[model samples]
Target: MTRTAPAPTRRPASTRGGPVRQGPGHRRAAWAAWGFLVPITAYLLAFYAYPMYRNLELSLRHYTVRSFVQGDAPFTGFANYLKVLTDATFVPALWHTVVFTVVSLAFQFTLGLGLALFFARHFPLSATLRALFLVPWLLPLIVSASTWAWMLNSDSGVINAALGAIGAGPVNWLTSPDWSLWSVTIANIWIGVPFNLVVLYSGLQAISPAVYEAAALDGATGWQRFRHVTLPLLRPVSAITLLLGLVYTLKVFDIIWIMTKGGPSGSSTTLSTWSYRLGFGNLVPAFGPGAAVGNILIAIALAFGLLYIRLQRRQDPS
Candidate 1:
């Protein structure tokens, strides 16, 4: 009656010799992952990293077309960078670049957000309309630039014709030094709107219907709801969008080149066009200084990229 079953004794780790139970399949999978990564790592090192290193080397050297032909370029340390900084076109081109980027981003974000909000509400043919709006983004940049150039031409252009009809007396859309930078800025904004629309619309779609419903129930107006609910949720997307816009807009050469050739007295020149002007625009190319300008652009991009990463870490912290 009193014979109760005794509990089983635990095995000691020393006697058990634990964790020796992994199979060959697990080892194969681990090896396969590294094997898969090897090609990607090698490709990145060969293509991106190596070229960047070579560019840095070129920037440090007193290289020219003759030196390239001779396969010898003597190192001049930071002289090329100094030359780029002191060059006549550098300051003005840099100023135009800043103004162009800022104005373009301001208009693009404002208009794109408006379009995104408009499309967020359910309506007839909304999806089809949204898809149609992506035409600007899908077209080649060179094509868009060429098209805008023709449209903005002062003579025999639709814009000038329309202005003349309205008694505005044919304002110079492209050739005037006062308006050349803004002309390209307008075209850039048009080209960039679709990208912002699609991205911001996706972000808006991710927001919960219940959240908006609750906000509406709490006596929030349309603007109030957008400010309190939508904006807060969309901050991350907007941050990345603007940062990428900065990087992309900063390097916009084709639009400025095709539209104005940085012309009408260097009014629309950006750093990218300026770099090209340095390296290949004329008979004697300044390869070293051009490379230096490109490297400076890369540095600015990398700084913003690092800032993006820091923001991501703050958002995650995991």
Candidate 2:
């Protein structure tokens, strides 16, 4: 009886026209996705791409203040880039910017991490306190810089008053080339902390409670739990926040401009402020060099962005 039964034939994968059918639904879904993306694509092309193209064009053009008025411009090729790179002022500005970015990133990240940790715990009045703490970031950049400038004024400023009370002499914070950069950094830190805190706090919230519970059950203390569980989980967020902070700090202009305007001796000039000074503020208006400076900044930011993307890819290979 077993031998007599014929083997059942296998059916083909397809019914009519093909082995496997992929119909209009798949094609429609793909078209719909492209349709959804069209608006943002158009916006980027119109705004960012066009502006960047124009800036690159401007970078190669030789246009002085007089040239701007008379509509007479000529191609200068890489001369602008050469001038910017060779300038003595540009070298010091670059050094100051690098130093400021490193030091400010350290302070902002450390302080922000502490604040994030503090706020991670469910404490009374934490929300209100956080709201109050964000006042520095909420304030306009010019206003915040102005306020710091006023406070740091050598004569009769609050800082000087405090110094007098503490028996420390009034320090010429902005007037001295030595302290002017630090003064800008301090104000920048105040503005930057809130952003870091918010980012880190959100990261902290994403950590699952069950993991903490499991750690506690395994006889882990708070520090141990945080070190093994919390810190590991927060690494991605930390990297993103730190990189973003670095980029923003690198592009800092308003605070430096408002606080020091390149200072009593050009000590506080950053790339952004230096670019503005070279391009628009000077009587002759060095447009080529200014655009070159801008291009340099854009390169740096793009580098950081690329690094972040690479890191993210490494972290999530799937």
Candidate 2 lDDT by residue in tens digits, 1-318: 000111111223335453232675877777887899999999999999998987887788888777767757798899889888998888899999999899888888889889989998889999999888888888889889999999999996799899999999989999999899999999888888887787788778878899999999999998999899999988977887777677677888889998999877788888898899988778777777888999999899779967766766665443
Q: Over the full model, what C-alpha lDDT does candidate 2 score relative to the true structure?
A: 0.83
Q: How do all models score by TM-score?
A: 0.88, 0.84
Candidates in order have lDDT scores of 0.83, 0.83
> After superposition, which runs of candidate 2 have C-alpha atoms over 4 Å from their true positions?
1-42, 69-72, 313-318
Predicted candidate 1 versus true structure: per-residue lDDT over 4-83, tens digit per residue: 11111111323543443378687777778789899999999999899888889889999878887886899899999998
TM-score of 2: 0.84
What TM value does model 1 have? 0.88
